[model samples]
Target chain A: MENENMNKITINIGPVHPSTHGVLKFVVEIDQDTIKKVEPEIGFVHRGVEKMAEMKYFNSFMPIADKLDYISALNWEVLYATTIENALGITVPPRAVYIRTLMCEMQRMMSHLLFLAHVGEDLGNTTLFMWGFRERELLMDLTEEVSGGRLAPMYVSIGGLYYDLPEGFSEKLLSTLSVIESKVKNEYRAMSYENGLFKMRTVGVGIISREQILKYGITGPNIRASGIKRDLRKDEPYLAYDKIDFDVVTEKAGDAYARFMVRVNEILESIRMIRQVIKDMPTGDVKVKVPWIFKIPPKYTFVRQETPRGEAAMYLVTNDDQKPYRLKIRAPSFYTLQAVKELFVGSKVADLVAILGSLDPVPGEIDR
Target chain B: MESSDTIKGRFPTLLSDVPSTNKNETVILLNDKSKLKTVVGEIKNHFDILFMLMVVDKPPKVFEMNYVFTNYSKNDILTLRVNIDRNKPSVDSISNLLGSADWEEREVYDMFGISFKGHKDLRRILLPEDWPGRPLRKDFQVTDEVRNWTGLDLKF
Candidate 1:
């Protein structure tokens, strides 16, 4: 009888594959159940965001930044606006900084919560998806209450925020935080991390070493999971992250389970950060006194900050014009995605979904 | 610290003569081909992270490529720039040292038509497979193909 091991099969998990998520395609070389190699074929969701920004006015590009990381829309806008502000030498008001920081933490919570729900669904725990979305909806409601949009909250403007938090926003935020914290704790304990099946599926699976992570320029929880104490918020504090007290969560094991645990704990820390921002927020003008349209000086500037996913960086070049000469985004997902090459080299085909879920990549961010 | 200062002070001497600035960051201009790789290697050894790679098109036949590197441990940024003739613009690829340079180098190749020697995969990323000449060059004209895709009947 001929040996079955003689044959090698190649699978194209596509630009449209549900498991692959978004427009990313993976061409996997497999032998039976073991994956020999995984080649990531990107540029599917490339909408020419950088090219479009070159044509649009500097301030008008905030809405485009909102679309890049649509899952964490407010953070994306804040990063772009802050980069412009940094280039132009403007300082945002104290109250605006606190509000921006609060909303950023809220967005961080929602992003992590969505990741939990999606990871649960990927692992066949459907109830956790509902629980995750249910909690995420409360936070989305708070976003709408403050920014007037549920998803694409283009609230952070250059040098400040677009507007102040609405009346009773603080009370609503506090109540929502309490409910989310309890639900998250219960669901995480019952369905994720602590669950035997989750541990068995994720622990020791998709393990990436600290050396490999640093070599690949991986950041955020993925790097932290490898025992690297490099959270940009704590290391390079921006906005009100410096004022608000919080812990930088890290896990020594650098596995899928470690990445998941880091995010789960980060949600609780975000709640703490939000509570502090609300309590310590000072009274001042929310918007800076600047003209609606302004020309930036001729210079190049680079700015970066911690987003829910990782370090989102923006590089801007201005030619003393209303429109920017060039805009380049160093999205965190793009860097984290590099680890997939190292993660899936020797893993089973079935474990690909779990590994990808732990990465929690936003393709819009990757392509942009 | 003195060694770092010597290297920092000698940055301009290593490159083709252009005014150098060492404010919060060090910016060196290079126009010589022989010094490009060695200068880049020196910068990379000093700064671990290659932060940004950018190409700018100046009208009528000149393109400038800039490589920015930052040393997180030392809290300093170093920028090295090279000017290339538009007709035959080509430079050495640094992707072997900085893995992050892979995509950015390809992007520079795609937009400005400046080739990076030894690039493993030099295919167009953001543009379509059969797209024409580079788009960012001042003299390069936008084709009617893009206009047709926009669903507008306006003449190009």
Candidate 2:
């Protein structure tokens, strides 16, 4: 009896659980119900992408990049191609930049919608889950129409896109945006944002302070939710983000609710950006002529893109050849997953999945 | 907060001349690996965030480790490059200074086999601990079993 009272129970959560979002396992050390310590056991989906990138050609790595975060595959595609473009000093046309920006914002909205569905299920609310996916299908349709693939869109290429925006893309996109904006504001908002049960579960369940965000290197919506006014679009201004006008969504709470609210508002902001892109889209070639055998000089460069989850950066070092000497992908989920140790401590076992879902980590990127 | 150019100017002896890039990013090369921990500490005085740490295997024998830091207040980026001997690669750990470095350093240790002297719990984060040689190293070769299966002795 004495030994039982003294001993803390160790529970294994998963490399396959539904709430984990992906193959992420955690060994939770607990005493009765309170979580004492959580040691995450990741690397389940490590496909050796970095090692594989070394063997592939500089431009041939786009397909591999798409696998990193399939939720926002276009973002990864654009990021990889842009890094290569930066290294080789290839300039993309203004029309191409606007189209790329449009695709990126659309990816952001899709990712957030999926996250909303994930958060809903994690909290045992199937209504929000259903509503999220229902609204998400519209955006997914638009994505397929514009990018040529629904999930893994390998549309973005070095110097520009795989092809120009098809005729009537802007018109179709504008109508879809209005419908999404209304659904999100009227129907979807009530299910998660305003519902009593949803608020009770998320409002203050997993509070991530600003200090925790910086110390743990958490970025994207997570950092913005914690009241940090930092967005790569506004700060770094890659692509057509500099020309567009939209507010950076932020909340002061730094809790689960705040994270949810931030992403929701960001969907609205993305809608605004997409509208601006369609309105101001210039006329020109979508892609420039890049060499078939792309060779980079001896140099090192880092290119950053603000993804749905956070900032995705690529650090490339070339050795005066067609192949990259070294390429390191800095995925946002990698840092966010590490911060979970600090976030999970002192939280109840019941709230574990809720907290984990709110962070919105994709194992593909985390283990890459 | 001091700008990246100003900070790079202060330590001419410790750093090489700043390289010019099309993006106008300030890149400072550090020839000395021993002074890395102190240099990072100095950078922290101005830039509070260590944006990223990337290790590149330079083909014949050098290993270049880049520590990217950014001053959030000023939007200035400072990249510190440290060249380490491939045969004996080690650097003082800055995990004590920044909590973010704990996992980043572990990852560096795991992927490149470059030990961080003061990292509290240095273990493999991505690959299995028992996995053969550093996979990210340019000279890493496939095991005999893998080579026999593929009919090629793959070497990165």
Candidate 3:
């Protein structure tokens, strides 16, 4: 054992590696390029958002909530809003729910596009990254047209949305959606899916077994990729998801390629949901009247919503105070991060980036 | 959604009377924190995973630790809440039972200053290893030590 220890070496991969997506570090023990152990070192971006919630008012924390999953801001915003709404026993207007649903799907498209871009770049495909961002820009423009914020919209409020859909927003969105849909089906396939080199890097790179997934409580696309067929939206419908119809994309392989395919198919699914939401959205007040200063009675409310990365939950503890007594933001990435060791161990160093990118964990959410 | 009564009936000995909270969420406060291992171990048949371990600081009393478990096949969620005395501020680690409890327990230790009896690696997860005080505690004061934290002291 002592002699074996002398041959193994440990290397540190960034709290700031370009391909890490955010500030994530990995301490790896390697024996001739084969990983013996991978200890994921996170919390570089821990902003104490949960502690911040205790200081801020109930309604004032939306801005902080928006920053949790920076990639899919709307989903975090919606989850936070829904937790408060559920605690207060307030039902949002039908129109607002539809709008929230539509915006969330759009954010899903944005997030998944970024995932593709990041993963593509990781596998040495700069064009795929550019292509991913190119389509994502159209979404940023559309969301900006309505919400006026590119990354953190701050559009979602306690009762409903801050603003109604902008003029000609539907027409522009429909056109953009079709363009993305076609590009995703054709261009994305031509660039990565059909490319032999792409398959070589991803097809069997990092595989998460069903047992590892359940053991780590992995949710969302990461879980779906492992063939469990579990999605919070379909299992327990929240927001406008009950009315909208879509399939929960799943892949049996549970490898890096399957994870990629799952998110790619989810983009198409989101496009379908967006179209349904637009056609069926009822016209009504965007937001309900909420008092400037109101307190939610003492109660514990837990609201889990399906974000692009996975199932994100926000648990709110209120004590008849304007601010939450304790606010726990459960980012999907946090649980997914827990399984990094189980997933990465026994894999090659080259496939490390491939696996991490496939899971798509945002440190903002993980550290929060 | 099942109420606290239905869940309590499953584990009669150690489960105390706990109030029901929200739809699809049944909160059960355990009578003994030590029984947590057995309770979770027994219920592992129905629940597939321990989704999250949430710690709520209820000062002047104790820390209310909630273990959220989910049964994906049945589409059910159960929150097993245990009260740890503020003085002792410790509980049994369930990481061996459900693999996800490892980091969450470490997180609780990091934020709430709650120790796990048999946690294999119960170090600060989200904060620096030498982070001065538990920030999530209600009475935790931000002293000059926390104020002067440059993070440069972080060895890694």
DockQ of each: 0.32, 0.57, 0.81
lDDT of 2 at B144: 72
Model 1: clashing residue pairs? none
Summarize candidate 2's per-residue lDDT along A1-368 as a digit string, tens digits.
88865878898999797393888999999988898899998888888788888888887888999999879898999899899988988899988888889889998999999999989989998887887888789888887887778899889888888888778878888898999899889988778899998999888888998777768778899988888888989988999998989999999999999999999999999998998898888998999988667789998777888999898889888889888888899998988988888888998888898889999999999888
lDDT of 1 by residue, A195-220 (tens): 99989989998888865665566778
The i-RMS of every model, in angstroms, reads 3.2, 1.6, 1.0
Docking class of 3: high
Which residue ranges in model 1 land beyond 4 Å of their true spot?
A1-6, A18-20, B1-12, B15-24, B71-74, B138-144, B147-156
DockQ of prediction 1: 0.32
Q: Is candidate 1 or candidate 3 better by DockQ?
A: 3
TM per candidate comes to 0.92, 0.95, 0.96
Per-residue lDDT of candidate 3, residues A103-159 (tens digit): 999999999999999999999899999999999999999999998899999999999
Worst 10 residues of 2 chain A by lDDT: A15-24
Q: State the displacement of the C-alpha of residue B119, model 3, in Å, after optimal TM-score superposition.
A: 0.9
